[model samples]
Target: MTKPIRKAILPVAGLGTRFLPATKAVPKEMLTIVDRPIIQYVVDEARAAGIEHIVFVTGRNKQVIEDHFDVAYELEDTLKARNKTAALDLLEKHRPIPGSTSFTRQQAPLGLGHAIWCARDIIGDEPFAILLPDVIIKSQVSCLKQMVDLYNGTGGNVLAVEEVPDDQTQNYGIVELAEKINENAAHISNMVEKPAPGTAPSNLMITGRYILQPQIFDLLSKQDTGAGGEIQLTDSMLKLMETQPFSSIKFEGRSFDCGSKAGFLSANIAFGLDDPKLASEILPFMREMLDQPEAAE
Candidate 1:
């Protein structure tokens, strides 16, 4: 039987240069979406997918993330004393079971491929999922769970993908499809990271979610720096495709690119609208913003 994918790697080593001052001291993954940090949403998704091990690839000044996952004993005790059952219950849900989570440091910003490689010791020989915390995906079904379901049947690498406009294909890793496995799935012929406009293989662009076979570690180990003088994950993935079956599953979800200020704000709004308590208050605020002449312009 194929080994079950029980582990996942989250790469959070990037210096959030886009958000500059705010990120100078804070990790971007700790930025709040509504009230929860971005990494919390990623962890929640992994938990929903039955991921038993979460290996975080971190870097300097990211201690807050580690603390966020740990039990806040002082805070919990105070809440308990105050008889705040609901708040205490919420905090408990954020705590991972002891020994189920681990962290490793990525001393340099070598890129996504290198970040994944940092978790090699923890991952050992099993297939694992990789989720980027910068991409907040909201879906009825967890994106990782959806990919895991596909991986079980296909028994190979699977990437979460979504169609982008032809002009925007250059901004993402584009996939070349060989055959249609189904309406929402296809055998990927090849993948190219950020192909120039009009030169892309297909409109389908890769999302942050991935289910990769452990064999990828070998390819990544010897990977030379590609694009931007960094070890790009897409390059190693392309090499792996040459020796194994690879496919892309079009995920059914709404993805928010939280790496940028605009995407971050938009995600906050989108999630706020989905909340029952906040929807009524948020709709009017959004409408007022829309009614402003500057907004129309």
Candidate 2:
């Protein structure tokens, strides 16, 4: 039987260079999409998938991310004194149980593989999930939950993949399918990180969610710098794939690549539209803006 996945590793060590000046002091993961931080959405997705522990592989100046999860005593006290029951209830509902979350520092700006490797001890001897906070997928079912459901049946490395245009394959880590497993999944024959445009094996690009076995840690430890002079996770996964089965799940969701400025703005608008309260205020304004771009500006 497949061991139940209980822990998840979130590699949050990257410098959000794409977001630039805004991320100078604040960690990009702390940036808000609509009403909550990007990290919160990612964590919520993990929690929805039945993950028991959250191991955050963080870097410098990312303490805020840690604090966000911890109890805010003064704030809680103030709310309590003010008799803000609803707000207090919301905070209590969102807070993770004590000892369920752990954080480790990645002292260097290594790479995604190294970042996940840093949390090896915390994730000892078990299958763990990795969710890139940069990508937020919105759907009736969370993306990680879908991957977890797939892992339960397949019992191997599972990745969330999405179909992309052939010409756009060069922009992502494209996968070559050995065969179709089902309507929702395919056997991943090989993975190529950002292949040259026309040479892409297939147009299915890896979306940032992963369910990997503990054996990946050993491969990442000796992984050499690949595409960017840093140990790439895809490179290590490729090696692990030689011995282990890797499959892809075409998750039912709309993903927002929050790492880019355009994607970030799009997420804010999309999420804002999802909120009933906000939609009533945002929709007509957006329609007007579309109808008269200059006047709205």
Model 2 reaches what TM-score against the true structure?
0.97
Consecutive 10-residue window with the lowest summed lDDT within model 2 = 288-297
User: Taking the tens digit of each residue's C-alpha lDDT, what string does model 1 give over 1-297?
Assistant: 567889999999889999999999999999999999999999999999999999999999999999999988999999999999999999988899999999999999999999999999899999999999999899999999998888888888999999899989989998899998888898999888899878999998898999999999998999589999999898899889889899889988989999989999999998888898899988888899999999988
Tens digits of per-residue lDDT, candidate 2, 183-284, equal 989899999999986999989999999999999999998957877788899999999999999999999988999999999999999989888999999899
RMSD of 2: 1.6
* TM-scores of the models, in the order given: 0.98, 0.97
**Worst 10 contiguous positions by lDDT, candidate 1:** 1-10
Off by over 4 Å in 1: none
Clashing pairs in 2: none
- lDDT accuracy of residue 22 in candidate 1: 93
Error of 2 at 32 (Å): 0.4
